[model samples]
Target: MIFMHIFSSLCVRTLTNRAHAIGDELAALFLLANVCLMVMPAAVRADETTGTARIELLHLWRTPGEQAALHVFRDALSDPSMAWFDTPVQGGATGVRKQLSDLLAAEAQPNIIQWIPSEELNQLFDLGVFRTVDTVDEDFADKLLPEIREVAETDGVLRVLPVGIHTYDFMAYNRQLFERLGIELPTSWESYLALGPLLAESGVPLLSVSDENWQLTAMYRTLMISEFSKEEVLSMARGEADLETYRNRFETTFEILFELRRFAAPDREDLRWEETVARVERGEALSILLGDYIVAAFDDPDKLICARSPQSSYIPWGFDSFVFTHVDDPVLLQGQTRFAKAASDIDNIVNYVMHKGGLPVISGVTPDQLDRCNADTLVAWQKRPLLWEGLLQGKNRIMAMNAVIVTIWRDETITPAQAAERVIDAMSRP
Candidate 1:
């Protein structure tokens, strides 16, 4: 089973990377594709003797907490007539998308997959990647949260199975560290900066962040969200902002992002989000500003202290979901329907949220100890803005923006004003 995943991803990457090169590379790619992962069929029949279907999965879940939550999901859908196999992809949605494309190009079909549910998700169904309705439980669509129920919905039919939900902007800290230093949560940018000297004297860092684009952007974007109203942020994202608006919006947050450098954990430019979470859990840093999903990463609940970022008044939410490739086999289709029903079951979702760290889509879910911070805050947080980070479907130059953000932290010459200028320049490009 382990050997099945190896050839497909590597073979696809090798062929794709060289396709743009001239002459010899083109010839090599043509020859290589013949012997590569195309030979690994996406769908395989069940063992005749056992009559158990093999449900292979391609997903982006790898962290300790996500893995644990995935196990719980598998258990809920487990059946004697089926078995689960994993083909984990390290490169997140982009990687999974690329590999899935290569497999499909080769006419191989990997049916079950993890996808970020958004408006664009319907594109998959439109492209003949999968279909809904008949594949899901009759009541599955009605069971989802209204916001989730509408995502990836084409016409009156939903195209994807909503799995887990979360907001990435929330901050979680070490309670013991804050108490030891007598530090209070910052209500505004000024207050956050005022704590600098206190944190400096105590020789503890203020927060942890990573250079990974999404991780850095979530932190950067949240700070932006704190500065702007929800309507303004959504408006800017929609490209309604004029030149001065971009300048004002970006510069204000970049200034705070620049100041935040003095408080960030040292030498964390290379850290992954999970590693940063561990830093806070170890009390090595005072806090970590990341998605609330990281709650399960901490072994002890006593060490966790949760808060929204400075002036964060909105609760931005998004759902993680699974979408299937069309399958004609009755047995496979039955398995898909079973999995969909299990995933949307209110009780199953509540239990899954225990390890997954977000609210169930339906109501009446009481906040367990870890979820109290995110769940309890929803009442007072007021505006429930659609989450902004992953929802952007390349609307702006993300790589260009990410490069400027990295330089803003590592190179002081790239001043906040200049970062604002460059960020606008990035945003302006096609």
Candidate 2:
């Protein structure tokens, strides 16, 4: 099996890197494809009789921790007593998408493909191109977080094995500073606003925010989602909700943003995200509202404490998964099942979270040795309802509207009512 995996990888690399090496490269690939067809049938027959199989894994990542998690899985697959050989074909997000596209079109099919859930997830499932989790292992289906498991399903069938749930909307603050100043973390948007005058009097900002369009846009989007439930947000986005119905909420959300602006750092526009967080780290600011990446940024883990924004009811998150692709060979099918099960096991779960810095989706697999902020994040993940990322589309549209709304509202160029109208107008665009 190992020999077969090495040979197959060499064939793929050769085909990829040497496509233009000869004028008849296309003809050569056609011949090679024919050779593969001839060889696979014999190999499948051999594997069935010998009880051995080989599978390929297409792994995706954006961080070093994720890369480390991939290595953990690879090491598990390398167990000496195992009957199958697994090889990892690696790439970043864009490369993973290209690989999945090719595999879905049946141009190539690795045994496992890792990716985030997207709008096209159900379409792919409906085509019968991937295996459901029930087909993999019934016990495995029982191990995932309820919300994470729910989102992985299509028509009540599980289609993906989740790796981690990574939340993006969170606030990190200095616990010591807050304790010293005798202020509690805000429990709602109103409480957040009430902190403004106190923060101003202390010469510390209520929040450390950046003027980076995406940063502000992400903050606004969270506030928008929190101001309304996911269902309401989606309805308003689809133009199903009348402007008059949501106008008050939109106005309130904008008011929160404007009020925070008054207490923000004077040079916030010139500060990078790291610099903005540094203010909170140094106790120069009360808090910073951003993504979970801040959990890993603290030099002294105990110095930071994180919580979901006061307005957030369900934490909006992104996740990674190992999605199984369909294969007819029984040995290869069994190998794929084992791969999925191995990924969901407790040891891998903890290692992935500890190394990868994301919340593990399986229950009872707490990561060890986390600093205060990361521990808080893990607790929040377990306690809060999960809203998977990418549910909110039209980011460029949101960013554009937010830029106009923030600029005009801050400068008193538009009334909150008119700003609400502009928001609805932006949503209505094609």
Candidate 3:
């Protein structure tokens, strides 16, 4: 009886040990499964990493010198820590509207593309296509020029990162011609008009305007700045003011544009901005009302002299910046944030723009970098107020300013007052 009792006890003990062992094995398997599920995707992404990025760039075929500025960006991305996974796929300049349409259609778009104006940015944001970069390093914003920093943001959100700072409404001159002709630089619209006949008499076109309507439009905005306060302009654009008020301003600016046209080259209707700049460079035209980017457009930097527009009190006419679309992809969003932060860094901004013969938007560039540029020209840009003068302002009235100028220049059928009326009509379009 005693032996039987001991055997029963041993059997019970064995069954308990077996049950505990099974539970241990099951727990181990569950933990392993959880880790595999959690970590596999990240491992896969890691393996797929190709150190080089494939980026598609869309920009106008400007001067070869301007095109070559991409090297500075490419080199900046070569740092190991930044780990850019892009390789540039260069494409010819398509119209801004067309490019946005195609970007929406592509299954996988380029990681980065040059941004269009602010109006287009609004449309892009509505589509939920762009990724917002929130993890930008604190120092990034500090590197940008105050104007660039202001323009880089929209509704308090930082959109595009500016690759360079540009002042679009400034004028360029042939120093030798101005000196030979013994003409002092014009200081105001009135002064400029005073010299127009003298310039025409010397057989040099007073201004070389491109047939491209945008250039003519830019001139109108510069003139508007002189005539109206910034608040008045913004209010008019937002439809807070009546057409009569806007028309009055528009007509005033148009009248000046018309008067300036008399001194423009006869073939101006056929000339593009590049050709116009080239004519000025060759001394066929005494001056051109263009932006600082003209310095990059010239093959020999020494041949050009850039200054704030003598006619507009030296206020800058336009600013270029980057905007991100509302993107949902975590990986892409991370990458863009990193890129934006690096690009906006003060040192990088200075390096990129200065190398391209552009002014640094960020302050504190070393003397060595500034030494490479035309010192006086850089100083002039530093003192100017950057303007955002493109059709991107989303004001129909403002856009018409360009159309009116182009139509008048081309057909020679409309008086300046009539052109101003047409501009008011266009701006009033729903």
lDDT of 3 by residue, 1-430 (tens): 5755554444334434443444323223223323322222221232333433322344443566665665566576665444443332223222433343333332234456565345455444444445444556756666666766665656656666676656655677877788888878777778877877887777888887776766766666666767776556767766777877666666777777777887887776656666778888888888887666666666665665555665454444344444454334455555566566556666666666655555666666544566334355566655654445443355665655555667766666677678777777777777
Badly placed stretches (over 4 Å) of model 1 are: 1-49, 368-370, 380-391, 397-400
Worst 10 residues of 3 by lDDT: 35-44
Candidates in order have lDDT scores of 0.68, 0.65, 0.58
Candidates ranked by lDDT, best first? Answer: 1, 2, 3
Worst lDDT 10-window in candidate 2: 40-49
* Collision count for each candidate, in order: 0, 1, 17
Estimate candidate 3's alpha-carbon lDDT, on a 0 to 1 scale: 0.58
What's model 2's overall lDDT? 0.65
Model 1, range 25-54, lDDT digits (tens) per residue?
Answer: 223443465566335454454442253454
TM-score of 1: 0.84
